[model samples]
Each structure stands twice: as C-alpha cells, then as structure tokens.
Target: MINVKVMAVLDLVSILQKREIAFSVEDGTTIRGLLEIMCSQYGPELEKKIYVDKDKELLNLNLYLNGRHIHFLGGLDAVLRNEDTVLLIPYASGG
Candidate 1:
C-alpha cells in the first residue's frame, strides 16, 4: 500500500483541523484519487464549500506533492510515493 500525507489549505483544512489526516492507498493512486477521497471524507456539505469544480480539476487550489508543483509535472496524473506530503494551497490574488 502507498501511504500519503495530505495537507489542506484555507477552509478545506479548517474542517479537518481537529485531527491528523493521511491515508494509505494502492501503490499507484494519483492525485485525482486523493482528491476524491478528500471530498468523501469531508462529505458533500464541506466539499461544496471548499471547491467550485470538484470533477476533473480543482478551482481554488494549487496542488503540491513533496514540495513539487503537480501541474508542472503531469497534473492530476502525477505519480506519488509513500511519505509524500500533498499540500493544497489556495489561490490568492491582490493588487
């Protein structure tokens, strides 16, 4: 099994802040699978609040696995290994 650490940002993490969140999966789980699991764990109510589009892509978040931006490599298909910390960083723009 593959073990992954997921860290959320903004309101996503706010809901799960009560406990340490991480999970074990099959050896080849992609970022897409990780996100679906997050939505399930948080449920529809919280999921509605955290994202605008919960389907193929994330709206408010910039994903990083082990400090490397997933988008730069292969987006949701990015391969992950055990002990990788997945960070969900929310987008912010200010002038």
Candidate 2:
C-alpha cells in the first residue's frame, strides 16, 4: 500500500480537524482517486480549499512524490507505487 501525508493549510486546519481527517492514506490509490474520495466526503467545496478551481486546476498546493514535487514531474496525473510517499501541502500560511 502507498502512504499519503495530507497537510492542511493553516487557515483550513479547522475543517480538517472538525472532519477528523488524518494524515495518511495507506491504500494504493492514484492522486485523482484520493482527491475524488476527499470531495465525496468533504464536499466539492472542500476541494477548492486544496485544489485550485472547481475544475481541479491545481493551484500552489504542493504534491511531493518521495520528496519530489509533482509539478516538476507529472503533475496530478502522476502514478503511485507501493510504499510511495504522497505528501500534500497547501501553500497558505498563518501565524
């Protein structure tokens, strides 16, 4: 199974904490698959919190594959391998 680290933006931590969304996905699923699942559970509105537009155009959110940014690689369509580390980090920050 793959491993995912879901990090919320500082401003969006409340939503994630409220929903009890943790920092891991232990199943071998594609990036798109995981995002879809998150949308269904957290609603499409939540997708915009992490993703860019409603059309899923990626914003400044950083998706790293074992420490490599997806944007510098395959973007969101990137494939996942067993034991791969998927880290999703929102660019927003707050004190």
lDDT of 1 by residue, 1-95 (tens): 98888877666667777334778978888887777787788787556654676564555567788888987869888877898888877776687
lDDT of 2 by residue, 1-95 (tens): 45555555455566555422443454656677767777777775568776777667765477677778877767777766655655666674677
Off by over 4 Å in 1: 18-20, 49-51, 93-95
Q: Evaluate residue 11 in candidate 2 and report its C-alpha lDDT on the 0 to 100 scale.
A: 50
C-alpha TM-score for every candidate:
0.79, 0.64
Clashes, model 2: 0
Clashes (N, CA, C under 3 Å) per candidate: 0, 0
- Candidate with best TM-score: 1
Give model 1's TM-score versus the native structure. 0.79
Worst 10 residues of 1 by lDDT: 50-59
